[model samples]
Target: MNVAFTSRTLSLSRPQLFRGIRKVQSSFATCSVLSANRAVVYTSNGDPSQVLSALTFSNLPPPPPNTVNVRFLLSPINPADINVIEGVYPAKPNPNASLSSSGKGSQDEPVFVAGNEGLAEVTNVGDGVTHLQPNDWVIMTRQQAGTWSTGMNVKPQDILKVPRSLNDVEAATITVNPPTAYNMLHDFVQLNEGDWVIQNGANGAVGQVVIQIAAAKGLKTINLIRNRNDIASLTEYLSNLGATHVVTYDELSDKSFRQRVKEWTGGKNIRLGLNCVSGKPTTLMTRLLGQNAHLVSYGAMSKEPLSLPTSLFIFKNLTCHGFWQSRWYDSKSSGEREKLVETLVGLMRAGKLKEPSHEILTIQGSEGDEEASQKIRHAIATLAKGQHGKKILLKMEETF
Candidate 1:
């Protein structure tokens, strides 16, 4: 499939893109009406390649009270999204979505749209809504908001308005990995400047973000990745992102590397450890932490269970915790969510954070349903086989 890859740079000249919505208004102007919409959906829990398909339906009517109609600008195909389609994820999609009634399935066989993270533009607002207006950019606040579609009607409360200064890629991909990195660095541990953080999977998306954010805050990071043929290039790339040390799992497994890590940190305690690939390597990571250090795990790319010696917990006073961005969103109110977005946007503006390296998989509105469906399925299949290293952002245009 022909796809486009690009990383958008920050543009600060257009801040007015995000304003308005001070008080409840009696009436709001709406944008040009779109007549048709399309989405990628699945009817059963199975391999995305076999179960996923493209769905087309009539444009959603004006939203109900307290809700707004939104046109999705861009959505991402994340690993968790694939897991959700495979029925292995904890969070499930809302099966009763109005988009299901497009005659694709019935009550006996409900159709569910795929996608959890995206950026959208408000096209219409219903009564009793005050915080948003047509054309304002927003992102889904609820898990499984069914964002892999051209448009949908969503409750205003379930979406958070974001700055327009952010490019399509930054806004679409911000909801998951960035927040995971930011919160893990800030919430679980009280890290001071000149401190040390060690994390495996340092070349992955979230790991890259952690390296930059920690560097921005004046903390040093020891990044670890799997040994590969391109080890030298990868290490140099991460070093350019402010990683103090970039070593492979092979180097980490060496007996003398522990003393080298000690010397690198000037014998200071490594107070924070982030693990996404859980297994023997992670256990080795825990052994390098200081007393009272916190170990936060977010993913298990290796699919191996974490097994750590009890001596580390007992003698070193180590603490282990799990982090999920969905749970963090569920625990915060709208105001708090807004603050989190605001803080991230500030970092973007200050050049401390950036849009992830990504490729655009555009499902053209002009294409036939079968053609579109085949493209989406092929992309998911490729991702499942670990072919694409950059993030995949889906651009579902409104059907004319």
Candidate 2:
């Protein structure tokens, strides 16, 4: 809500005063976020607990030509984001001092801001911008743009306008997990109504999205998750989200489970398998696939190498591949991205898709450096524990 108003003074001549008035009007007319901006910055690559800090930049300038000023509303704490901050991610952020308004940080070496995905609102626009206006909602189109901040200034094309009909959580999360599920489901196999697909880590964010998307496409999912104390509740949750079948890792080991899957699919071929948890879970999922079935591995949460029996490839003719949503996005054009978003938006509006359970961590906009750093540090610590099944989101704007 930080904004500036233009005022006229009588001490100046008509020509001078008029010129001054226009200058002030041009900067303030769009309702810019004129206060100091805050961000979570890191100077060196290491654990987030050791290197991350909060910084405030003062006297921020307005967006330049063809650019728009964006105030962040929500940013999700993805595991990949933590990896980026640790310098292990494949895509690294570019160092730029202009990200901070205050003349702080070394000119020779710059710092990096954290977070990858989030939702933002446009607060001001440059002269040549036409696609977006003040108060418009948007999401980052590219990764590694440093989303954990109060606000930022960028070109209009860098963000995609979000439909007002979608809520903060839905809009904030659609860029990653949902798209990963959608792409993996469509790109690897030609599935039809009632076609069965089996996947490990079915309780994870991507797995949940996979269930919903598969259901919307009239495909069935054999969802597998880790055995938790609240196994029944977790099973019910995925079932409510349209999972055709739900089983825990323990149940997956049961000798009768193969027969159960057979009865569930009515002996029909399960053409696709999605493996996120590697090691034994991946091998187990691969065994369930039918002839010439596709097995796509996207993540190795167990940090275990996939053990594939040669017999599956030689006898069953199983097709194995891997998927990374970031790579897919990098290879595609903006038009392709738009098409994917449009399709997901339609499904969401039609109630065929829904956001998974998530938790909101409110980061105060006015906290001091030490206070803000402590809050973020505690949040990161909590994230590392993975205590909750809900996705952790940084709710930046107070009103939200």
Candidate 3:
């Protein structure tokens, strides 16, 4: 282990540095992995072949400075993660380390881990790392790659340290869905007490969090979900999270749905419409908003293109924006991230926040575990099956 004594006043001795070095080494149960060499690659885009065995691809060692060796404590597979492996997702590549040698850094390399986000703990810290000690919990500071494996050696700047109080699940889920909901609610619209917000995919990871957050902040929510026979059950469940009204897409398509929302909200201005679904759903949502409201699109799960009237943009003065939580969170310091995590954790501890509903699946594959991948596909196929939960995780491990 290398040591940097920033100031003469510093107190780490030789023995302590030696201990830190030992602590920084990654020890995984899988001995077949030689992390110092090539990483496992997903050579092509397709089915399970797309997430095929981490075949070898040659690469140099970890890039220099401001980097760290990270051991994956856990990587949870969410829907977007499955889309990435299928090679259909817009976002691309997950590299554990990028070639920062030329200053563009290893992060630029195309081949990397496949997860958009996951939780990790530090194993080694290169020069200039002070805030993080070995074994400290962290979430990715950037997006794409390097999160699906057992461990990775990456830059310190790409990993955001979590508050000691945050649980692994919350930490791993930090980078994308949760923060997207957070920023959309707080950043785009200037919401006020008693204001109302409407959103699609209400039972989604982001949507569920929005329900609770909006309620916590004294704002009401009108949630939208796809048609399910148990729609009534789903409604009651979301209402428990503070949603004011829960309606189906068919219900939403009704000419009176907007009137119902306006009536339910006591005609209080609905300032924000969160869209993860495009096409007609988004078009109808745009009309539902109060004048000058913001319509934020974060995903196009419907796979259908967006179509809307120009009159809304011209006359209603609506502002349309796109958001990516990964990009926004990457700009903050480790310190700021820890604090945001602290607030979220505090909510969790106080019963204000709940885990995303999930069905844990053990990964079992011919060469490795395939259960995680299978379960992921299942989750995507039947997303609206459940009334109030999102998949907890799709984890890859050596043994069941």
Candidate 4:
């Protein structure tokens, strides 16, 4: 459904405020006349393929004070995004949004846009916004910002300006996986240069980032993945990413692998373990840790409960903690977030950080609403079936 835009006059006392208002008003007028926006939206929490639809709407009106209008360049479809859509995640979308397929909405019905992380360019800034201007690149710092749309109005505090040097893919994905990996490594334990780290699901996006960051820090990683047919090739691929050793869950199941791990680390204590795949495999990995080691879990890819032996905790002094990047963002200020982004960008510029392998699913403005909806639904269906090994990014055309 299309939204209608209306202009409002602002009462400004300062000269700078008047100038900002005029600039915003002019930009808003142009956008109201020329722009059409579309979003992947759903009314209720359920299977994305059944609930999600392509919603075409008028461009947003002029942003209110302390807000900025932004056009999203790219947004990634993270596994967490799917969980959020299914209503299984902790974060919820803002339901007060005025959106509908028929250009009308009742108080009882609320529309939810789907997406959390994205790269966007500021198109206009409202009065009282001085740090951002037109064409500045930014990434959402707010959880569940509904980034699937072509454009939206956001608070200045909810977004952080990123360096233009970062390519679209890197900027789009920088807000989530990389930060998760970076924080888990630094926040949990203080590892020496030759220390060892162990993790399951090591070929997944965050795992790969962990491997590279660990390697850069001169720490070793014992990477774990599920047994697959192309085991040798996968090992080689992860090894090149600086994984000291790549082991399958089958190998981890064997009792002798613990001794092998000891030999790999030269009998040194494995100080930190990262777990995304919980269950018996995680318990097996935990057994290999030395005294006072920490285990940080960020995800449960296997949807299994993390059950660990009590003996390990009591005898070995093993510490267990849960991590969520969204929580991390909530705990930090905008300046702190900016500093983290700067560190990641430096890593990217220095070749220490590389973009995750991804496929872009483009929704063209030229396509009819049904055609676009079908494309999104098909992609979500494929993801639901575990068909995609790489990340899937959504690139929405502006003129929808």
Please give the CA lDDT of all the candidate structures: 0.88, 0.84, 0.68, 0.88
Deviation from native of the Cα of residue 397 in model 4, angstroms: 0.5
Candidate 3 lDDT over 307-341, as tens digits, reads: 87999888888898988766676577767776766
- lDDT order, best first, reads 4, 1, 2, 3
Off by over 4 Å in 3: 1-40, 48-51, 54-66, 94-111, 125-128, 330-339, 363-389, 397-400
Q: Which of candidates 1 and 2 is the stronger one according to TM-score?
A: 1
Superposed model 4: Cα runs more than 4 Å off: 1-35, 100-108
User: Residue 240, candidate 4: how far off, in angstroms?
Assistant: 1.5
TM-score for all models, in order of appearance: 0.90, 0.89, 0.75, 0.89
Model 4 residue 90 distance off true place after TM-score fit, in angstroms: 0.9
- Model 4 lDDT per residue over 45-64, tens place: 99998988887777778989
Lowest summed lDDT across 10 adjacent residues in model 3 is found at 31-40
**For model 4, the run of ten residues with the poorest summed lDDT:** 1-10
Residue 383 lDDT in candidate 4: 92
Displacement of residue 76 (Cα, Å) in model 3 is 2.3
- Angstrom error of the Cα, residue 281, model 3: value is 2.2
Tens digits of lDDT, candidate 2, 123-209: 999899988899899999877888888888877767899898999899999899999999999998899998999999999999998
